[model samples]
Target: MIDMIQQFASCCRAAGLRISTSEILDCFRHLQLIDISDEMQFKTTLRTNFIKNYREQGKFDQLYHLFFHELRTDIEIARSTPLGSLVKDVLENLNQNPTDNPSKSILDFLSGDPIGFLEEIRSIQSEGNEPMQGPIKGPRSNLGSLARRLKIMLQIYAVQESIMNFLAENKSKVSWETNKNLKTYFSQRLDRARRYLHEDPPAYPDNSSHVTSYEKYLTQLGERNFASLTPKEVDEMRIVIAHWVRKLKDTIGLRYSRNNRGIIDVKQTLRDTMKYYGVPLKISYRKRPKRKGKIVTLCDVSGSVWSAARFMLNMLYSLQECFAKVRSFVFVAEMDEVTRIFENNDINEAIDKALKEANISYNADTDYGSAFRNFKRSYMDALNKKTTLIIIGDGRSNYTNPEEDIFDEMREKCRRVVWLNPEPKVFWYTGDSEMRTYEVYCHQIRVCGNLNQLMDFINDLVL
Candidate 1:
């Protein structure tokens, strides 16, 4: 029992759940007090002891489901049926030797110990890949593991082929219902794997440098996904965001302090020494580089991506005091500059006003090709070596021309282009998402769905 618990904990960590040795020990002690035979008590004991907060529960529950239910045998059924032994014997006999092939991992997955399969999927989700080489200007992330998953999916088909062949040769011994049940079991596991491969992982918050407000509700709202909030929570989020703006203002002040000046300005030093009769008693240095307030953002303000964009726009509004120029655009099928709207009103009111007044075609679908084309024609001049162009959207181009060439042009015009994807990494290349194509153009790409991600990105962006 102790060894089983330890192995389960290892799997959880592999799947990116932060479990500690102490939590594992505590879980062992608690299990002694509960009826381990009772599924409810067993699961509750593990979850309560290991999980820290509501936010982590999503991933904790997923791991628990995979470990306890998917991998284990039902007690009554195990006792009544000899099919378990029979199936094991047949699978082991048919299972091929470990070799360097995509089928290798699939075979391990089917051996009923999911650790290998879990590890493979975990690598995909967390982006275990080599860094990009050559003049490729963007990230080298495996791009939601689509290419890898495609291979694994093919391997699954190959395994299914083998399983069917085994069933055919041994049809006399295996009942039709037994064959159906075996196929069903394999299908279910494959389905689970598909979901893990394609769906979003939970938003795991970073508590390293935590921030909170006197209003507990507002703080909680800050932690929640912007899309999940209610109208009441939205109002509370604005209050919390205003607090963040004030904090950033202080950070900006400290950054511009004279004490933070750069390396000594030799030319300025020579000029100052001449003023002092070449005594050279005092020195002059370069002033801190002025804050580049030039912000060009192409925000997708339609569909679910809108929720995160609106909050980001609110934060940008607060930053107007820091930047000399802040230019923003809203887009769906086309784009429109909303800098005037931000300049004219309070940021909070400006958000609501921009949503209504901007030429954002809410009824139309998102088109990155169209949007970037517009940006190139009119707003490309807005970019320079001093500016940071931020693209805030899910990168879902609906199978249209991604126009990655235009992104190359934009990157040339700007110091850096940052892609802030609100969608989770697992869904990066799934469905209509052109994330794989768009990622090649970004100087940096990050998943920014909730407050912690947003806060961390802003901190790195400015300070």
Candidate 2:
């Protein structure tokens, strides 16, 4: 029972609970003070001993049931049966007569044929009894001690099996499906990926063939081509790459927009005042007025570029932490401002609303020309030298008129016209893609396929 309590405490600690030695000792003391005759009283004592917060009460209850709740029939039989003999029998039955019935559930095995199970448990106890050979008067049987130890062991086995079953049933809920060690590895990888996306980019391997000590095992996997890698390995690599890209973006802040007005440029301010060295500083300060900038994102949410659009939306959502004024627009055949949708806290809900508002269909063909023309006609006044315009799309017009005039007008009106194309540079003029024709009007044209490329493009924007 003492060992059982200690093990349960350990499990709670592993599950992010803060459990101290003092708490464990206090629990044991409380258990001794409480009457064991009443099950409810015993449970209350246990809860009072270990649980310090109401929030943790439910967690404690789960642990208690997992660790100490014995099979009712086992307890009844153990009370009457010779514990040593019963343990030996149970061990023999488990080893020699292991059940081959695949149809039986774990719960059934634990609860079914309780009398036979208890007898087998008692047999295991008997096998462990050793004769006393020291100053003891005679061979003494530590039957109660053996029984308690057996109980703890059984409880551990039951808990382990239960956890396995729970994991098997809930595998789909997890991001990665792998062995225990791999699952832990994937979780760490995910954490690293998220960190990279939001923080400064880390150094990449200088040499591809000369694998770093950290990823030596991964490099040794006999994979000659990226396509040949297993799905699990590919997913793992993708996560790592995604993290690297995210970190890169963090290191290189958005380049298109000017810094916020709240941030004072002491050096620039002082330089401007240098012309009035002998004059009043107030006059110079008045001459150099502070200016705020606006960020306008025009994302192509058409069927051709849905993946890239989703990624851009995610980045825009994350950018809310850095910027104050941000407006978003999604375009398929037409464009609609989705700033309010993005302003909502829930990203999934926001995206759904944005898609609905834009009437974006996954099957619809892209018409960047019409979308640009519509935006120019409806919101031309919104464009100014203070506004930074970011357009994310594949630059594919699906044989529609390129509408280069609208982009030309946009470049003249906006402070910057940045075009982010998901397709490679070679695909700019191929097929119905009008990227080559559209590229001439934009201040910067960047290839943004994956998160890394997108991060680099964003970094370049603020520069």
**TM-score per candidate:** 0.49, 0.42
| Candidate 1 clash figure, as a count | 0
Model 1, stretches more than 4 Å misplaced?
A: 1-219, 262-286
| Ten residues in sequence with the least summed lDDT for candidate 2 | 100-109
Q: Residue by residue across 1-463, what tens digits does model 1's lDDT show?
A: 8988888888777776778999998999999998999988998998887777766777878888766776665322334577666566556766542332335555555554566777777777656455666888456776557787787777777677676677777878878888787777667666766666666656677553353434565556667887898898778777777888799989888778847787898988887888779977777778877766577888898888888888888887677666667788988988899989888898778888777778767788789999989888988888998788999999888888988999899998888899999888999989999989978878899999988789888888767
Reference-based lDDT, residue 290, model 2: 26
Scored by lDDT, the top model is 1
Per-residue lDDT of 166 in model 2: 45
Residues 1-463 of candidate 2: C-alpha lDDT, one tens digit per residue: 7875676666556433577899889888888887877889878876776666655665566545534653333444445655323333333333343342221222232322222323333344444454656788565577754665445445434534443454456566443433353234223423332232223222333454554654665444322233245657645654554564477556544332334334455566677677788343632222223234667888887754655665566656655544446788888778778877777657656766776665555456778888888888887777788888888888887899878988889889888888888777887888988887987888888877655576566555443
Evaluated against the true structure, the overall lDDT of model 2 is 0.59
Go through the candidates in order and give each one's C-alpha lDDT.
0.77, 0.59
Q: Model 2 residue 299 lDDT? A: 86
Model 1: ten consecutive residues of lowest lDDT: 96-105
